[model samples]
Target chain A: MCIVCGCGHAEAGTGEPEHDHGHKHHHSHGSRLDFGGGPAGVSLPGLDQARILRIETDVLAENDLIAAHNRAYLSEHGILALNLVSSPGSGKTTLLVRTIADLKDRFPIAVIEGDQQTSLDTERICATGVPALQINTGKGCHLDAHMIDHALTTLAPGQGSLLLIENVGNLVCPAGFDLGEAHKVVILSVTEGEDKPLKYPNMFAAADLMILTKTDLLPYLRFDADRCIDYARRVNPKIGILRLSSETGHGLAAWYDWIEARRIPVSQQED
Target chain B: MHEMSLTNGILRILEDQARTRNFSRVRTVWLEIGTLSHVDPEAIRFCFESTSKGTIAEEACLVILEPAGQAWCLDCSQSVTVTRRGDPCPICGGFMLHVTGGEELRITELEVE
Candidate 1:
C-alpha cells in the first residue's frame, strides 16, 4: 500500500505498491481501470478507508481557494457581490439600471459590466450616476473569479456599496464558477420562454434567485411563467424568483427590498 | 463562447505545471466537462488548437469526458443518471431529486512529454 494513505499504491509519483498488476481488472463500469499503484503490493478493490479518502480529495482545489479568497475579500470590503448570469439579451443590464435608480437611497451602488468588447453597458450604468467599471473580456464568454478580482480592485468600491457584476451574457459558461458573490442572480426573460430553466439547467441550479425580466412584454410573448418556476424548482427548489420588468417599473420594489434585506454582516465577513 | 478564456485558463495552468514540473510540452489534456456545465466541447477544442500554439500545451490532444448528470432520488434513496438537467430521476421518476454531480467543469489531467 502507498505510505501516503493506507489505500492502494500511489500510481506514478507517490510510492504505493501495485499488487493487482496483471490481474482481472473489472469495475462496475465495463471500462479498463488503471489503479495508480507502484511496486508495493496494493489492491484498489480492497483499499483501506484512509487511502480512499485521500484519493477522493478534490482535483480542482485551486478554484475553492480562489473562491474562498473572493468571499473574504468581498466581505471585508463590504461589497455586495451579486453575480448576474443570463443568456444574451436577457435584460440583465436593464434590470441593473432600474435597480440602481430604485435603491439608490438605501445603498450606494456600483456596477461591474463584463462584455467581450464594448462599453455600451458601462455607459448605460454610468448614465444613472453610479460608479461603473467596464471589463471588456475581449472574447471571453464568461467572467471567472480572477476577472472579478481585477474588476473589484479597479472599481475600488467603498464600504456599503452594492456591486452588481453583470457577467458575460452567456447562460452556460458562467454557472459553475464562484466569483465570491453574495448571491447568483439569473435573469430569464419572458421572450426566452419558460423551458429555459430546464434547458439551461446548471445556471438555474446554481442561482440563488431567479429574475424573470420583461414581464410587461409577456403579453405579446408565449412564455409560460408557471412552467418556468416549475422547471426552476425541479432543478433547485430553494431558488427565489422575482418576475419583474425594468422598463415599466414592475416588481422592482420587491427586487430592491430583497437585496437590501439580504445584507452581509460586515463584521462577520473575513478580512 | 467563453471557451477562449477557458483555453487561456488551461494554458495558464499548463504553463505553471511546465515551470514547476520541468515539462516542455503537453501531449494530452483530459477535461471532464459536465453535461450541465454549459460549455461547448467543440468550441473549447477549436479554441484550444489556436490557444495552445506556442504555449506549453502546444499540440496537446484534447479529450473530453462527459459525466452524466446524477440526481439523488428522495423516494428511492439512490442516485440515478439523468439524460437532461432538471429532469426526474431515471430509476424512480421522482420529482424530488437532489443533484449530486455533473455541474462542474475541470481540467482533470495532462500527459506531458
Candidate 2:
C-alpha cells in the first residue's frame, strides 16, 4: 500500500546519496540505483491522504544553478570556457589537439576531457604539454556543471587562459545540460550526414558556433556543405559557421579569431 | 539515454522537497513536459520507474502533461503551433519560427504524505 498510489509496496533505501565530495571521489556513480518495485502493502500512517503539493520546480534547476556558478567563477577569473560537443568520431579530439598545439604558446591553455570510460583522450591532450583533466562520467551520457566545478578546482585554469571542455561526444544529451561554458561549439564532420543539424536540431539550436570539421575530406566525400549550413541556419539563423581542417591547418586562424572575438576582457569584467 | 539522468534530477528534487515539506513518501508526480523539450514522456516514465526505486519516490506514479509546441514566426509575425522542432510554420510555411513555448520540463505537483 503505497502512500500516493496504493498500487505497489515501498522499499526502504537511503534517500539522496551523498554529493560528490570533491575530485578525490571522481568515479563514484552517485544516485544511480537498480531496484525492482517491491511487493505491495507497505503502508505508512498519516501519508494516506497523499496531499498534492504544488511544487512547480524545474527538473534541471540544480544543474542550471551549478552552471551559473561555473560561469560566474570563470568570468571572475578571466577564463574563457568553451564546451565542444559533437558525435563520436567527429574529429573533435584531433581539432582540440591541433588548437592546443597552435595556441598554447600564445596563451595559457587547459583542457578537460570527458568520456564514459578511459582517459585516452586526456592522455592525448596532455601529450601536447598543456594541463588537462580527465573526467570519466562512467555510465553518464553528458557532463553536468557540478562535474566541471569540481574539475576546475584541480585543473585551476589560470587568469586570462583558455579552458576547452571536450564533452562526451554526444549531440543529443549534451544540448540540454549547460556546463557554464561561455559558448557551446558543435562539430560536424564531412563524413557524418549533411542533415545532422536537421536530425539533432536541439544541439544545433543550442550551439553558438557550428564548426564544419574535416573539410579536407570533402574532396573525397560527397558531403553537401551548403545544404548542411542551410539546415543549421534553419535551426539557428545567427549561429556562426566555420569550416576547418585540423590535418591541413586550414581555416583555423579564423576559428582562433572567432575565439578571440568572444573572449571577455579582464578590464571590462571589473565593472 | 539522458532520461535516466533527468530522472535522477527529478528524484533529487523530490528528496529535497521531502526534507523541507515534511513528507516521508511520494505517491504521484505530475510532470509537465513540452513537445519541443526533446524529452519523450514514455522514456521518462520508464526511467522514473527504475530510478525511483528504493527512494522517497519509490513506486511513484508519474503523470506527464505535454503542452503543444508554440513558436513565433518571424516571417508571419504571428504565433504558430508546432508539433515538432523542425516543423515549418503552419500559416506562412516558413522555417524562421523562433520557439516561444512548449520547452518546459518541470515537476508541477507532487502527491505526498
Docking class of 1: acceptable
Regions of model 1 farther than 4 Å from truth: A1-64, A265-271
lDDT of 1 by residue, A117-198 (tens): 9999999999999999988878567777777777777888878688899999887878867888989999989988688888
State each candidate's chain A TM-score. 0.78, 0.80
DockQ of each: 0.36, 0.31
Q: A98-154, model 2: which lDDT tens digit per residue?
A: 999999998889999999999999999999999999999999999999999999999
Model 1 clashing residue pairs (backbone): A9-A16, A10-A16, A11-A36, A17-A40, A18-A40, A19-A42, A141-B2
lDDT of 2 by residue, B43-79 (tens): 9999999888899988888888676677889999988
